[model samples]
Target: MADASAGRAGAAEEAGPSIRTLLLLAIPALLIGIASAVVLWLLDLVSGWLESAIWDGLPHAIGITSDNPWWILVVLTFTGFAVGLVVWLVPGHGGPDSATTGLSSPPPPIGTLPSIGIVVLISLAGGVSLGPENPIIAINGALAVAAFARFATKIPPLLIITLATSGTIGALFGTPVAAALVLTGTVAAVRNGGSLWDKLFLPVAAAAAGAETMHLLGGQTIAFHLPPYGTPNPIDFLTGLLVAAFSAGIGILAAFLFPYLHAGFHALRHPVLLTTAGGLLLGLLGIVGGPITLFKGLEQTGELLAHPGDYSAGMLAVFVIVKVVALLVAASSGFRGGRVFPAVFIGVAIGLLGHAVIPGIPLGLAVACGALGIVLVETRDGWIALFLGVALTGDLTLLSTLCVIVLPVWLLVTKAPHFEIEPKHGLARPPTALA
Candidate 1:
């Protein structure tokens, strides 16, 4: 009995990866991580560059600073141009399926990368209320798969997939914790797929390597700081639950609007036309919402957190409406990016709404808290969303504690139907003469 136990321990110890194996996997993962960061950073840079060029050229554009009644026409026209180009020139660049694409899917993107990248950038830089995370992730996943297959002598298919998934973990939403949540979910999925516990090491290594690489390369993500808070009381719990209820509605709205907006612009399909039109709409809304609603809301989230009460009741209402409309316009118009940032923004709006309704709570904090709560509700990925909320507020205690409070309600929201889609292409055919 002693010998058997000893033998099992020996095997387990050996079965687990050593520092050496970690380094081996880390080397490749580091490369992939660096690549993801570079690509992400470049994508942002491109959007910034485009915005500057566009604005410089058209300073007097009517919709540039305010919502004109004709703003809808402008959005339609620009999107029509984009859709025309995508359908006419780009053969299979369907971009991404925002309407239906949810999280999770089968291995590796085979096609639909450049189109996705282009679309996201166009939307974000064109002053749309979105960020460039999700599309970038899918693209990164594809790149990792391609690289894995090219190197490593017949690396087991499962290992290749795990490695690819891991490569993006550290770079998840531009934070290590975000990467951990994503990779942890991925690991859960893999474990469920088969009795392949050994494969987890590969992804762990890849994620570590990727994160370390991002650190080395100075690929810092955008800054957000959630505030600190005291332990939740019944009041906090009830408030969070209420916010979750609203957030579920927000998620559904986001899901539906995301697709409808895409279809709206796709109806036109001209790049310049779609972009110009979307820009015009956003610009016009910017007139009332100010520049805050015109571009990706990432930069302004912090400002909102800092002075939530400064915004008037009328202004908050307009801000919420413009952001929702702008997200639809940008996402639907073939712009490339994720709606996560915009979703967070919506959460803030909801939080503010909550305080407004109640009349006694710290309205600014309430708005921020509600915003953070809704993120947990929408993504069904709590810790990272929690982190994002905290980061947004620049107050960790407040955000983290709020995260704890909101967790129960957010988990309840998991029962809500999420939007999901499969990859654009079907799997490769097996050999004709094969078994």
Candidate 2:
């Protein structure tokens, strides 16, 4: 018994790093955070430039106006061809189909980073209904790991991954606490004996540095400008619950359809044919939904909210359908990106529709519930979903309501299929993927 105790103690001591070592490593972690933020900024700049040129400038240069539906179709179809060419011919197959992977999944080889970046940039610029979060994280993670291995061999690969992910998350949401909230569940699930907060210390430090750097460099926030939800009435709670539940149900339905869409797209068995078809479909959806349903939805979200009165419930419903289908197409068709931002847009539309129909519920609360439901369904992480709900509306008061609202929604989606793709190895049965 004494020997076992001694062995366990030794193992614990070895597993935990000393404060001095951690503090010493903080410098590199900070540098990594700064670098991650810079990479995101560069991606944003380039994507914005390309999106403007390809989606707007080129068409205008040819005398096409924004109202012309055929122009959007032509541009998106061409985008499909371009991305297909890159994915088919480029090495690393454009860095794995994102629909099949998690945000923190192992990155591809460092040599594949450039190709992945190019592909992601093309998707982002081409008005695909996906965000840059996943690919950017993978790109920064791979580069950070390689860079650290050269000079900081003592640092564990796991720690490097955590720091890079934290930094990228901070940049993505424009706040360190965003990273903290997103990772809290992951850190808590670790079996190592220690305070969860202690495990989070280093990663939080990196996130803080990353978030601050982005802020200093003019990082934008996704906060919606809306009137605050006044005193919470009992009826508001029921409305909130209903809104979240309905949105979650919609998201789950989409989740179930995800794998089939993925399989059908891959049925082409060639990247060129698969991605080009996906692009053409996306273009058709865009033509049906118009310009608002295109893009990653960050800027489009604001545009939608800017004049909520401009759109009817039917129009908002169309937005929801088009964006959801576009997101699925983009993800399944081998585009490199994340679903969070597009989900946000869809949630916003859901919230607006809820408010329009109900008329008694607060807009802010409706939006929060909408975001809460969809994000929870997509991420399967309660903390992230709640945070997104409150964060998007810039209302901390909504947290308590969301806390209660996420319960039933969670129950509904707990055993449902995840929003990820099936693995290639076929060894591990994905949580609820298609056979």
Please report how far candidate 1 places residue 198 from its true position, in Å.
8.0
For candidate 1, report its TM-score.
0.75
Clashing pairs in 2: none
The list of candidate 2 runs beyond 4 A from truth reads 1-16, 426-435
Off by over 4 Å in 1: 1-19, 60-80, 102-112, 154-169, 192-222, 225-227, 230-234, 256-290, 328-335, 355-368, 421-435
Any idea what lDDT model 2 has? 0.85
Which candidate comes out best when scored by TM-score?
2
**Candidate 2 worst ten-residue window by lDDT:** 426-435
- Candidate that would win on lDDT: 2
Q: Please, what are the lDDT tens digits per residue for candidate 2 over residues 274-360?
A: 888998999999999999999899999899888888889999999999999999999999888999999999999999999999969
